[model samples]
Each structure stands twice: as structure tokens, then as C-alpha cells.
Target: MVLVTGGTGFLGSTLIKILVDQGTAVRAIKREHAVIPDALVSSSLVQWVDADITDYFALSAIFTDVTQVYHCAAKISYQPADHAAMLHVNIEGTKHMVNLCLEHAARLVHVSSIASLGVSKNGELITEDSKWDDGADNSKYAVSKYESEMEVWRAIMEGLDAVIVNPSVIMGVGSGSKGSGVIFNMVQKGLQIYPPGTVGIVDVEDVAQLMVMLMNKPEISGERYILNSENMSNKELLDRISKLLGKPSPTIEAKPFMLGIAWRAAKLVSLIKRERPSLTREAALAAASKLAYSNKKIVDATGYLFKPVDRTLEETSRLF
Candidate 1:
């Protein structure tokens, strides 16, 4: 049986649907108040378990008879106010899961983000071997993910069979206004400002498929693969979404000065509404930076080709 954490999330839910369809017995762990996605609601092959990853006793019990474990639960935030929660969930929670997996001796597949990977300083492509520089201007989200991956690496040293996949921005349908889907929604609403940063993007299905493939290949243990399909500027990506959605493409380029003002205004609005700011200072900086990742490692390792991100965007636009 396969145990998947964060099974109610965008990627995790999609993965459970695929596994159940393939007649794989899956034990999915979700928060008690988390609503099950419509796609997995009727699947009898999925055994739902309600428990937080931080609860070692609860999680340890669920690991019984599990052959493979997929650690997908994570906290994503760029707000400074959320850093504590991010560390608790993304770092400490992962440590608990790592310990449990070690005790059960189950093969583990950790779903990490490209945020954990280091940036290229010499204008070169970032690959699996890039060293994460802690002194760099990394976001709290990136720091949390990097620390979580450290737990996975620590487990590997202690005799855990595990592999990690660092996926770029995941794009697909069914995520609604969450995750990378918010980018599509913003474009459809006639967002006029475009960030100049270049980002690596991959389809949600491709990420899930690669995780399953890696889990089946024990020979690939103790290695992490970057799962990006293509690298494109934010303007190009938004324009493609705009065309597919029949919306006007962004006309204004967001310079650093403009983004600085925008984030401050967003912070004031968030304070008034007592809600999280739509644009944090860290997120604003990331939007204006150019970063690209390489998928050569994963492509060469598994011989699996990723679907073109532009096609994925076009297909996802139809669903909206």
C-alpha cells in the first residue's frame, strides 16, 4: 500500500486520482477539516486518514504495511508573519515524517520545490548539483523548503531509501484560484503589469507521473531530480494565458521601483483587512528577478518527456 501525505492538496489530490484509477491501494492523510476534492470523493481504493504530520503517533500508525510514502504536505508563504507556521509545517513536520518512514523502512518519495534549489550566479542554468547558498537573498518559503529537504537528506544518511523531485511552478486545471492557477486568474482579469522574471514551469500531471515513476525505481534512491518542462519569461507566460483566455495581454512592465511601491500598498491594505497581503516584499522581488532551472537531469534519468507548458496552459484555459 502507498501512503500519501497532503492528499487533499492540488498535486496530491491529482496523484491520488491517478493511483486509484490504476488499481493502486492508497492510504491518504489529510487534515481533519480539509475537504476532499471532488475527483477522489468516489474512489473506493483510497483509505482516508485524518492526522497532521507533526503528530508522530498518529502518522506512525498510518505507516503500517505501507510500502511507499509520498511526502507532499508543505506550507507555502512569502509573508514574514507566516514564517513561523511555515517552519513548523515545512521543516518540523517533515522531520516527523522522515523519522516514521525510517522506522517503517518504507521507500520515500519527497515532493520538494525549485525554491529549495540554489540560484545560478554566473547566468548559467541551475541543475541538480547547484549548492544552496544560505547567505543569498532567499525567501522564507525557500528557506523552509531547503530545511525540509535537509531532513530528507538526514534520513537518507541513516538508511532511508528516498528520492526527491524539485518541480518548478506547477500549472494545470482543477486548482481553482490556488497555487499557480492564481496567475491565470490574474491574467484573465486584465492584469496590465507583467513581471520580467523568467520561470520554469511544468504541468501538474507530469509532476505526479514522475513521482510515481521514481518511486518504482529503487535504483534512483538518494538523488533529487529537477522537473521543469520549459523556461519562459513571466510576460510570455501571461501573454499565452491571455491569448487562450481571450483577454488582453499585459501592457505595462513592472520595474523594481513600481513593485516596491505596490508591495507596500498591498501591505497597508492587508493590515486594514486583517488578511495576508497579495504581494509580499519577498514575492515582489522574486517576480522581478530572472531565474531559470534545468530539467536535463530528470529527462536523462527516466527517459520521460514532459508536456509542453504552453500546451498545458492552453488546455487549462479551456477548463476555466
Candidate 2:
């Protein structure tokens, strides 16, 4: 039996659908009162359990008879106010999940983010061997994910079989203007300013497929793979989305100083409205930083090809 955490999330729900379609008996854990996605609501093969990963006793009860585990649950936030929750859910929760996997002797497939990986020192493509610099200008979310990954490594040292995948920005349809879909929605609404930075991107399907491939290959254990289809500037990505959505492309470039003002204004607006800010200081910095990731290791290991980013945007545009 296979168990999946964060089953209601975008990537987790997609992964569960694939697993169930493959005739796998899957059990998924979700937070109490979490709404199940429509895509996963009709799956008879999935047994849903409401449990929080941070609660060890409650989470451990659902691990019975589980042979494989996919750790897909994570909290993502760039706001300073969300630091505590992000650390609790991403780091402490992962520690508990790692401990449960160790006790159950279950093979683990951990879904990490490229945020945990290091920035390229020489402006080259970032690979698995890139050293994470804790002192560098890193986001709180990155710090949380990095520490969470350390927990998985600790478990590995104690004889738990596992593999990790660090995926770039995952994009897909049906996200309803949340997560990565926010970018698509911004373009559709004629966002005029584009950040002058580049980033790696991948399809959500590619990430899910790669996770399943890594889980089935025991010989590939004890290593982390970087999954990225292509690296492109934010302007290029937004331009593509605009064209696909039949909207005007972003012509104004948002420089660092401009972004600083924008983020501050957004924060003030959020405070008044009692809503999360769409732009945070950390997110603004990330948008202005150029980063690229290499998928050579995963490609060579599995000989798997990724869907082109433009094509993914084209397909996802229909959903808007």
C-alpha cells in the first residue's frame, strides 16, 4: 500500500490520480476540514484520512501497512509574518514524517523545491552538487525547506531508504489563479510590469511523473534529482502567457527600486484588507534575481524528457 501526504494540493492530487489509475491501492492524508479537489473526489482506490503531519500520534496511526510514502506536503510563503507557520509545517512536520517513515521501514519519495538547493556560484546552471550557502540572501521559505531536507537526510543516515526531487516552479491548468497559476492570471489581466530575472520552470505532470519514476527505482536511492524543463527570463514567460491569453504583453520592466516600493505598498494594502499580499519583500527579491537549474542528472538517469514551457502555457491558457 502507498501513502501520500498533502493529497489535496495541486501536485499531490495529480500524483494520487496517476497512482489510482495505475491500479495502486493508495491512502492519502489531508488536514482536517481541507477541501478535496474535484479531480480526486471520485477515486475509489484512494482512502482518505484527516491527520496533521506535525501531530505524531495522529499521523502515525495512518502509516499502518504502508509500504511506500510520498512526502508532498509543504507550506509555501514569502511573507515575514508567515515565517512561524512555514517553519512549523515545512520543517517540524517533515521531521515527524521522516520519523514515521523510519519506523515503518517505508521507502520515501520526498518532494523538495529548488529553493533548498544552492544558487550557482559561477552563474552556471545549478545542479545537485551546488552548495547551499546559509549566509547568503535566502528567503524564509528556502530556509524552512532546507532544514526539512536535512531531516530526510538524517533519516537516510539511520537506514531509511529515500530519494529526493527538487523541482522548479511547477505550472499546470485548473489551479484557479492560485500558486503558479497566479502568473498566468496576472498576464491575462494585462500586468504591465515584468521583473528582469530568469527562472527554471516545469510542468506539474513532469514533476509527478518523475516522482513515481524515482520511487520505482530503488537503485536510484540516496540521491536528489533536479527537475526542470527550461530556463527563461520572467519577461519571456509573461510575454508567452499574454500572447496565449490574447492580452498585451508586459512592456514595463520593474527594477529593484520600483519593486521595493511596490512590495511595501502591497503589504500596506494587505494589512488594511486583512488579506495576504500578492507581493512580499522576499518574493520581490526573488523576482528580480536570475536563477537557472540543470536537469542533466535526472535526464541521464531516467532518459525522461520534459514538456516545453511554452507548450505548457498554451495548454494551461485554456483553463483561464
Candidate 3:
């Protein structure tokens, strides 16, 4: 049996669909009260359970008869207030997964993020082998992912069969104004400021596809793969999405000082409304960082080609 965590999320649900299509029986777990995506609601091949990854007792029971595991559940946030929660979910929760997978002898496909990777010290492209700098000015989310991956590596040395994939900004449909879908929504609603950073992007389907392919290859365990497809400036990405939606591209390039003011104003507004800030200081800083990722390892390992970011944007835009 195949077990999947975060089955209700964007990438997890997409992975479940592919497994169901291949006639693979899957046992998927979601957080208590998390809504089941419509695409997964009616599938006989899928068995949905309500459980928390951080709750080891609840998660351990679901590992019964699970021969393959996909650990896609994670908490992603850049806010300082979310730091503690992110550590519990992303780090402690992964510790449970590594332990449970070891007990069950189930091969694991851990879904890590490019956020966990280190900065290229010599102005070269960041690869799977890049060293993570402990003293870098990392965000809370990056710290969580980095610590979580450490749990996986620790387990691997103890004999757990696992492979990690670090995907760049994942773009696709079904996110409904959350995740990267928010970028499309922002562009459509007349956003007029572009960040001065370049980001790597990949299609959600490609990420899901690669996860399944890796899970089936037990011989390739204990390796990490970067899943990025393209590297482009934030301005270029926004322009393409805007053109697809027939909206005018952003004209103003937001510098660091401007971002500081914007995030502070947004934070004050959020305080008044008792809601999370739409812009945070960490996010503002990240928007201005220029980084790139290399996907040569994954491409050579599986010979799998990623769909163009343009095609992914066009499809996701139509759904938006």
C-alpha cells in the first residue's frame, strides 16, 4: 500500500490523482477538518484519514501495511510569529515520519524545498550538493525546512531508504488564490509593483510525477534532487502572467526601502483587521533576493523533462 501525507494540499492531491489513475491503492492522511479537494473525494483507490504529523501516536497508526511513503506535508510561512509553529510541523513532524518509515521499512520520498538549499558562495548555480550556511540570514521557513531535512539525513545513516526533492516555486491549478496561485490573483487585480529578484519555477505536475518515479526506484535512495525548470526575474514572470490574463504588467520596480514601508503599512492594517499580514518583512526581503537553482541531477537521474513554465502559467491562468 502507498501512504501519502498532506493529501489535501496542492502537490499531495495532485500526486494522489496520478497514483489512483495507475490503479495504485493509496492511504492518504490530512489534518483534522481540512477540506478534501473535489478531485480526490470520489476515488475508491484513495482512503482518507484525519491525523496530524506532529502527533506521533495518530500518525504511527496509519503506517500499518504502508510499503511506500510520500512525505509532502509541511508548514510554509515567512512570518516571525509563525516560526515556532513551523518548527513543530516542519521539523518535529518530519522526525516522526523518519521514525515511522524506519519501523515500517517503507521507502520514503520526502518533499523538501529549495529554501533549504544554501546560497551559491561563488556566484555559480546552486546544486543539490551546495552546502547550507549555518550563519546565513535565512528566513524562518528556510530554517524549518533545513532542520526538517536534517532529520531525513539522520535517518538515512540509520538505514532508512529515502530520496529528497527540492522543488522551486511550484505553479499549478487548484490552489485557489493561495500558494503561487496568489501571484496570478495579484497580477489580475492590477498589481503595479514588481520585485527585483529572480526565482526558479516548475510545474506542479512535474513535481508530483518525479515523486512517484523516485519512489519506485529503491536503488536511488539517499539522494537529493532539485526540481527547478527555469530561472527568471520576478518582473519577467509577472509580465508573462499578466499578458496571459490580459492585464497590464507592473511598471514600478520595488526597491528595498519601498518594500520596508509597504510591509510595515500592511502589518499595521492587518493588526487593525486582526488578520495575518499580506506582506511581511521576511517576504519583502526574499522578494529582493536573486538566486538560481540547477536541476541537472534530477533530469539525468530519471531523464524526465519538465513542462515549460509558460505552458504551466497559461493553463493555470485559464483556470483562474
Candidate 4:
């Protein structure tokens, strides 16, 4: 039997499908208030339970008969006004997963983020040994993820078996309208401009597969693996999307000062709009910051291959 948290999410649902294809009994945890995906509901091979992991008793009940665990649930938003809630989900929730895994003797596969390791100190493809000291500069999303990784290290000290996969910005088919909205909004709105910058890339399917491999590889415990396929400039990404959508691409690059003013103004509108601000100062910094990482370690360690960037873009574009 296998346990998958966030199984209806982009990566987790794909992982659940993979496990079901392999004839493994899969159980997943989700909120009772949330809508369950039809595929998971239709599959007789999967047991979808509505429960929150932060609740110890709920998690204890779901972990039963679970030989291996995939802890993929997470909460990353544009600007998390509720910092305490985000911490509970990302930090303390991880602590619960570690404890529950140990109690069930289940092999744990934790889904971490590249932000946890902070910026690449040398402006190069960051490897596992790269340090994260800019926890203060990054957003609450980044801080929460960084602290979550620390939780794993603490678990290792307590003799827990686990492996971590750090993925760059994920792009692919997603569940409902969540998780990938920033990218979706840009594509949906038909952007005529984008800020000048570069960012990392990874397909959702690739990340899902890597998690299964890490779960099966005993030697992967206590290691962090990066899963990035390319380092692409903002212009390049917009151009690709433009060409696919047959629309004019954003050519004029906005100056950093101009972007800052626009972002602040947009944030003010956000306060009145009653939803997340489109142009947050935090989002702008993450956008402007160079986001690239090394995936050679993941390739060499797990024998995983990535889909070509053009193909990944094409498939995901079909969604929009």
C-alpha cells in the first residue's frame, strides 16, 4: 500500500496514476471541503480520504497500511497574508509527516522546492551543496519551504528514512485553477509585455516520475536532487507562448524602476480588488531574480530524462 498527500495536485495526481498503473494500492489525503478529481474517484484501485494532515489523529488514520509515503501537499501563494497558517502547513505539517512516517515505518519521499536552497552564490547551476542564507530576502513562500527542508534534516537526525526532490518552477497540466495561476494568468490575459529576467523550468510529469524513483532508491535518503530542464529568459518564454498562441509577443522591456512603480500601484489595486495582487513587490523580486539550478545530480543519481522544452511547452499550451 502507498500513501500520497496532495494526490489531486498536479504532481501528486500524476504520481498516483503512476502508482495505480503499477498495481500498487494508493491512499490519498485531501480536504473534505475541496472537490475530488473525477479520475481518482473513478479508479477502484485508489482510496481517497478527506482529512487534514496537521490534525494528528486524521493523519494517523490515513497512514495505516501505507508501506511507502509521498508527502507532496503544499501551500504556495502570491502573497500569503496569513503567515501563521502557511507556516503550519509547510513547517509544522512537515514535522507531522516525519513523525507519522517513522511510526508507520514507511519510506518517505518529500517534495521540496528550489527556493529552499536560496540563490546560487556563484551565479551558476546550483548543486545540492549550495547553501541558502537569504531566507530573509525571499518571500514567506521561500522561507516556509526552506524551513520545511530543515525539518527533513532534523528527521534524518532522528533516524528517519527520506529523500527530497527540489524542483524549479513547474509547468504543465494542473488541477482545477490552483497552483499555476501566475503563469496561467499571463497566458490567459495574452501578455503584451514581460519583465526582463531568466527563470528555471521543469515539467510536472518529470517531477512526478522523479519522486517515484527517489522513493525506490534507498541510497537517495538524506540527499536533495534538483529537477530543472532549462534556464530560459523571460523574453524567450513569452516568445514561445506568443508563437504558440499566434499573438504578438511582449517586446518592449520595462525598466526596473518603472516596473517597481507599476507593481506597487497594482498592489494597491489588489487591496481594493479583494484578491491577490497581480504585481506584488515580492513576485517582482522573484521574477527579476535569476532562477537557475543544476539537474546533473538528479540525472546521474536516478537515470531520469527530461522532455524537450519545446515539446513540454507545446503540450502545456494545448491546455490554454
Per-residue lDDT tens digits of candidate 4, residues 142-215?
88899998988888888889988888888876633565535645766777677777888888889888888888
Which residue pairs collide in model 4, if any?
Answer: none
Rank candidates, TM-score, best first. 1, 3, 2, 4
Candidate scoring better on lDDT of 2 and 4 = 2
Q: What C-alpha lDDT values do all the predictions have?
A: 0.91, 0.91, 0.93, 0.81
Model 1 alpha-carbon drift over 4 Å, by segment: none
Q: Lowest-scoring 10 consecutive residues by lDDT in candidate 1?
A: 172-181
lDDT of 3 by residue, 68-108 (tens): 99999999988878889999999999999999999999999
lDDT of 4 at 207: 89
Question: Which lDDT tens digits does candidate 1 get at residues 62-164?
Answer: 9889989999999898888989999999998899988988998899999988999968888789998999998999999999999999999999999999999
Clashes of each: 0, 0, 0, 0
- For model 3, the stretches where C-alpha displacement exceeds 4 angstroms are 271-274
**CA RMSD of each candidate after superposition:** 1.0, 1.2, 1.1, 1.8
* Model number with the top lDDT: 3
What is the per-residue lDDT of model 2 for residues 1-320, given as tens digits with 9 covering 90 to 100? 89999999989998998898889989999988998988778888989999888899998889899989999999998978889999999998999988988999999999889999967776888999999997899999999999999999999999989999999999986566789999887887779999998989999989999999999998988899999999999999998889888999999999999999999999999999999997899999899988999999999999998998888898899998
- Alpha carbon lDDT of residue 186, candidate 4? 73
